[model samples]
Target: MTSSSTQHRPPIGIITTLRSSLPFLFFLLLLLYLISTSKLLIYPPHITTKITCQDSNLTTTNNHPKTGYDTELKHIAFCIAASSKLWKSRKEYIKLWWRPGETRGAVWLDNQVKIKKNETLPDIHISQDTSRFPYTNRQGHRSAIRISRIVSEALRLESDDVRWFVMGDDDTVFVVENVVRVLNKYNHNQFYYIGSSSESHFQNIFFSYSMAYGGGGFAISYPLVKELAKMQDRCIKRYPGLYGSDDRMQACMAELNVPLTKEPGFHQNDVYGNLLGLLSGHPVTPLVSLHHFDVIDPIFPGMKRVESIKHLLESTKYDSGSLIQQSICYDMKREWSVLVSWGFAIQIMRGILSPRELEIPSRTFINWYKVLDFTAYAFNTRPVTGHPCQKPFVFYINSTRYDELRGQIIGIYTVHRERHPRCRWKMESPEKIHTVVVLKQEDPDRWLRAPRKDCCRVLPSRKEGIMYLWVGHCGENEVIEV
Candidate 1:
């Protein structure tokens, strides 16, 4: 009887133990599911990856080791106008013919113009006389044609040694530091000409328009100059009666499939006028030259053009020392001010939404929320309303996750509409009220909305609702309890 009683008791005890452990097992499984689904817990610090060449040999090499031109490679060649017409008075037509250095051009070619320590100045040559050309009435076109001829002669003179020939208007102001920097980037063996390239436009009916180089500035590589010299006669025959010689020259290069690279911060439009502020802040450090078209002013009588060049050369001594330094400081201050304003706005927005914890999946923590926060912070301080994806406040979340979170009200914060004038306010649901936990009294006011008696409600059957939260103001009047 005792043995039978013991067996029944053991079975009953085992059954009781299994029933007690069921609740604990169920709770453990639920916690595991929540941990698996939360994106915020899984990913952090989402970073974009960029591809770069891995070869050690791909690194940039410095070519310009010495101050001046390498004797082995003659690079610089001067193209001076041999027979240029000079006006006697302010309103007068050409009264006398002079060489490049005889009038204002002479001031630029003076002893003060020295080549860099290691850099070499090429053989100088003059352009052919314009009297031989059929188009004598158009002085602008004639000058451009003469410059082209000079470029041809320079290429021919030092055919083997030189790689580039620089042609400039007599009144142009050049910064040698800028030119040397560009020359240093390439191995003297490679050939590439640098200049501005723009699509052609037709402004007047009298002229048939086509793509051309801007008249103010340009630089040609040694190979390009050589090719142009070889094709000079053919270009003249192919494009007969071309309106602008510079345009025609560019067209010739285009026909040869020679691509032009742009060198920014090298040339200035004002030859005599000082550009203390503009060149200093440009991303490109070195500037090549300045093209001052109106250095000889038609407005002021008795203003000798050579006198202006001399004054400008003297002014350079003062500007070179302090002008760039001051401009850089000013630019830094402006950029810092912009960053500070943006940081302040981000702090305010974060403070307003402090009550809510972002409930994202662990996998999405780094990729989605972090990116959104960064974007929102950047755009909030801008003067104008930023584009949706471009601004800091707006972030791209997975559409599926967004859809799940759409109806859920997570925090109380202010919303402002900047660009749109006539925005309509509509309550989506009358039955469902959203509870906004405010930390301060003035938070809702900053958002430009009136206070309400009850916390905002979401209508049970309705699909959408808009609600805002106030910080510190916990009063019945301040709370919108819908």
Candidate 2:
């Protein structure tokens, strides 16, 4: 009789069931969040483990004040990746230049490098996992795969002891002291990925603008390193078509929502030319590392690449000061102008220049009220070692007349020098006169009035197939190569 009266119960609505469980779900998630943030301590008491080097010579400094902050608390591990092809030169260079006494490092190899049994190297060895990638040996794609494996291995080693994981090519030069100093600026407890772009915009276009060009080397904080190691194998597998370790690393970072934090001290040297064009002007930042010495000459003046590097190391020994004062100057063939009051060279492109003066000492000192595209422009400073311009040439284009000379190359050079230089103003037009003046010791009128003067002519138009920034009217030799 009860069965006859049995009625089908109304089906429970999904929304109603979800709503009923919401409180419990929320509480669970909140607990996880708290634990993840280390707010709710569920784990056992953490032991403050001190990192000790296996070698007595390797002393890990925990805190040093002169670096402007405490950095000894963190340990930096370097993973210098190398190919067997470059084994001889790179291994020797590492032994000669790289000082691993303060930090931990290892050389990752794709193949075994033959070295004398007595010869001590930075524990150089190839990846034990011979699982071959689709990419051929020495190809950048394969290099990227190897780097992922290297990073995975590095993370597995003494997890708590490693605060930072640095990756560099065999040719890369690391100023460990400066690297430590720069790392000190950021909290090691947080996730950080530091690097810079290649000097070549084309390479960036082909690969990725966000990537820290591998040549300049890069650093990953311990927290980020752990996160990366988890997904690295999967990430590498996905980027089968990508090239360059840096580019692939960037792609993986994108998936993890990590951005490249640019540090100017890391020189990609993607551009072709003497670095004098770059390093000369007093760079305000400290020089942390320089890469691609294989392509260009070394940074230090007047020595072979290796010797120059050694010389640089000696000069900055125990010194945490900035490499340059931000007065660095480089040459460009593009249209340029000078700011009279403030010492700056304004390169004229499609963008308009700000009429006002920005700052003295160097452009790096003052924030640009308006972007004038001044990096390519040259100031009074000479990056060239021998010809150090004591009283550098400075000039200004009339901003009111900027429209008239929008795309014209302007060159300024030291004609002759006096201890206390006088600024010279030359008016080229009446409505908005184009002006030129020296920066440092200024008496503009006196120099213009002087019959005998150093002459520079930035022609209004290009001649034949070539354009010239004529400095002293003496044929091609006097022509300043933009």
Candidate 3:
């Protein structure tokens, strides 16, 4: 009964099986090693059809340039986001800044806008449909997803020789030359998200401090825009809960690891009422853009909103670098503190005010959050001087021109109001000075170097009713003093 030798062979000893097949195992391992090293022609794995991963480096440019680079209007592509219905009225604001045959980019509307023939504006383009993009924000419109795509859209439209892609709302007003100046400071070949946050403290807190409010406008370097375009749609898909375009763009910026390169010049104007106080105390930076014209009083006190913006542009043309530049000087003999917001407004206070105190904005404009909530403003704001004696004698620009003969800029600012309360403590009142003649030497290169508030000196004038003031670079040791 040798049942076929019941040969289990003692179930092959653990090490014996390996020892017996050592050569085969070694051969198999060797084959695998060779295959891994590509030394053997192995069978190809099945070619799976899948979505291609984005090549981030495809559009990345050299962050640093070796040669001199100057950014110009031609180098920037502006993508203005607007509601199709609002385009008619808002185009006036855009026309104030957009120079036809010079400026590039388009106005991205949610739908086609009925632009008039020969309208002085950028090309109007209906924005690509964004209905497929999920937007779960309970309070915000889905247009946010559309507006957030503007930079990417503009990038695709004008990729060649474009250094920056500037984005804003149709109501946004840009000092285009100054926009060039600000963009020039950074290497556009690098990843840069340049703009200021919302003027409203609550708006910034609600959205993000790093976001560049779209109403105010923001600039994205060409390289950054290209990279953003690569993933913007996907990025928007991920951020379905964002409240606005700026926040969504900011979210994508976060993904790209780029922080907001804040240029305080961009004004979100997240406030209401007169903008006089805000513009008067502007920071000593180029005034690149102004937004929220639809919500606030005209920048200049006495003119229509569009006309006022154009008047400001009139001054900007002669000296965009110095426009809204706050140059504080004093008529010490008269005991008056004169603040010449060059190309903007003039504020004459009855008493000597230290520059430190006057630099903070006066709360003339209504805060977006709450008029009474002093904490609602993003920056410091002193309450409007209810005391007539301490209040400023306001003046707005009447006209501006490049005095070709003098090779400088001449700005005329007249009293915004007819009369004011009599100041008891005044050495000599500004009331007699019917007009302020501001003469500024054209220093196109002013912002090219370091930035400081230009100095204003009250110059003698033979005319009885007019006061003459000169604004320019202060002397080596000059300081704004009382």
Candidate 4:
């Protein structure tokens, strides 16, 4: 009976075995697919959500276009020097007097004037008495507060109707258009104060949200001013001194949980060098204001204003044949010559090197190309190759003493494409092959040749190698040996 049983049963049929294993095979495939698709399994981390105010009570209608001047809610007031002496001594005198003849005529003045069609110019009272006060130390703060009060009085019909009060300095070159545009974009009604905030600690006492425009250009909504005026007793009790008036105001608003929207490019510190560029020539057209601190002397204001106006007119005019044209032509020719010279130099270097010596080491080649790519990316322009007269390529030899060949293999080569055709490639093929030269590590002046046929090699496992080969762009036909 044992002998009969011992006769081995025929091996399980292949079809039967496959049928029995099918479910397991399917389960394994399904699991692999899930694993491949599950990014959470590979990388699990928490994401933080950013929060901000979403209350609608803070909305403002100050920025909207006026269908009728009466419909507008905000009014701007300038704290001009009241007395003739104050006006004569003010830094804004220059701007107000600049091109006096041009603006003196009623017709020209009307065209140049920016008053809205139906909107009357809010009465701008000159406060001679206030200007004479010895509040020069807190002059800016005093001026802002006075302007705020004046604005509050100007739109008195509706105590709750007013939404924003913009107070600016006399010398400041204000841009009403940009002020309106920005206020509209940000919806100024949502915040109580909007200005340029600075984080500098010394000035932090001025305001945690120190308006970068200093105390010169800022917008205070009616609600905030009302709240401050109502809580004047508490605010004064909390912050008793005038030393940090701006700071006190900001602190009070913060206590009320009022947010301040910081608007950049709206205010210019009168002395900033890029003032012309920042203001885009028409400071009054797009910017909120220029502090004019640099023009503290009354005469300089007029001079600066004249210069600004002249520059603006020139910028607007078309030059048919002027120095500008000649300069442009000369620049173009010089640049072209430089580029041609560079190309010739690169060609000469390429001709001097043997094919094997021209091949750069992998790391060195990658680094060099990376430099070129970085420059191109930064400038948003093409790489410039070297010219014949200019040495774009530089060599750096290893000087460290730790290794025997420490001073042996290091060198730097720069390829300025603008001057050298050999160094340049088609704009579309920014990553293509280009000429490279090597020099003695110790004596960079001495040129050396590379020994490889190609500067870089395709790694066997790299997808780039396979794809490039498939596209027939790879030089080597054989598969890379791992």
Better of 3 and 4 by TM-score: 3
- For all candidates, the clash counts are 42, 18, 0, 27
RMSD of each: 24.8, 29.1, 31.1, 25.5
**Regions more than 4 Å wrong, model 1:** 1-74, 81-83, 87-126, 129-140, 197-216, 268-283, 293-482
The weakest ten consecutive residues by lDDT in model 4 span 320-329
Mind giving the per-residue lDDT tens digits that candidate 2 earns over 382-456? 221122222233322111111112221122222121132332323121112123321121111211121221223
Candidate 3 all-Cα RMSD: 31.1
Residue-level error in angstroms, candidate 3, position 229: 1.7
> What is the alpha-carbon lDDT for the whole of candidate 3?
0.80
Give one digit per residue, the lDDT tens place, for model 1 in 215-332: 3345676777777788875665565456665566666777778666666434433212322212222221333454543542421123355443333333223222111111100012
* lDDT for model 1: 0.33
lDDT of 4: 0.32
Better of 2 and 3 by lDDT: 3
Best by lDDT: 3
Higher TM-score: candidate 1 or 4? 1
The predicted structure with the larger lDDT, 1 or 4, is 1
Higher-TM-score candidate among 1 and 3? Answer: 3
Q: Tell me how far the alpha carbon of residue 123 in candidate 1 is from the true structure, in angstroms, after superposition.
A: 8.2
lDDT of all predictions = 0.33, 0.52, 0.80, 0.32
Q: Write the per-residue lDDT of candidate 4 for residues 1-482, one digit (tens) a residue.
A: 45574485546697689889999999999999888554221111221121112334322235433332321213332322222334333333335322322211011010122233432223233321234322334434544333323333333433544556564444444444344444544443455577764312223333454443433466666566666666644554554334434455565667877766776534434222222112211211123444553433221123365444333223112210010000000012112111111001111122122222222111111111224233211111212224433222321111111113322221111233343334442222212223222211121100111111111121111121010000011133422221
Model 2 spans with C-alpha error above 4 angstroms: 1-69, 117-120, 130-132, 136-141, 300-302, 326-482
Tens-place lDDT per residue, model 3, 62-149, is 3423323677889998988989878778888888888889999988888876667887888878788889999998999998888898
RMSD after Cα superposition, model 1: 24.8
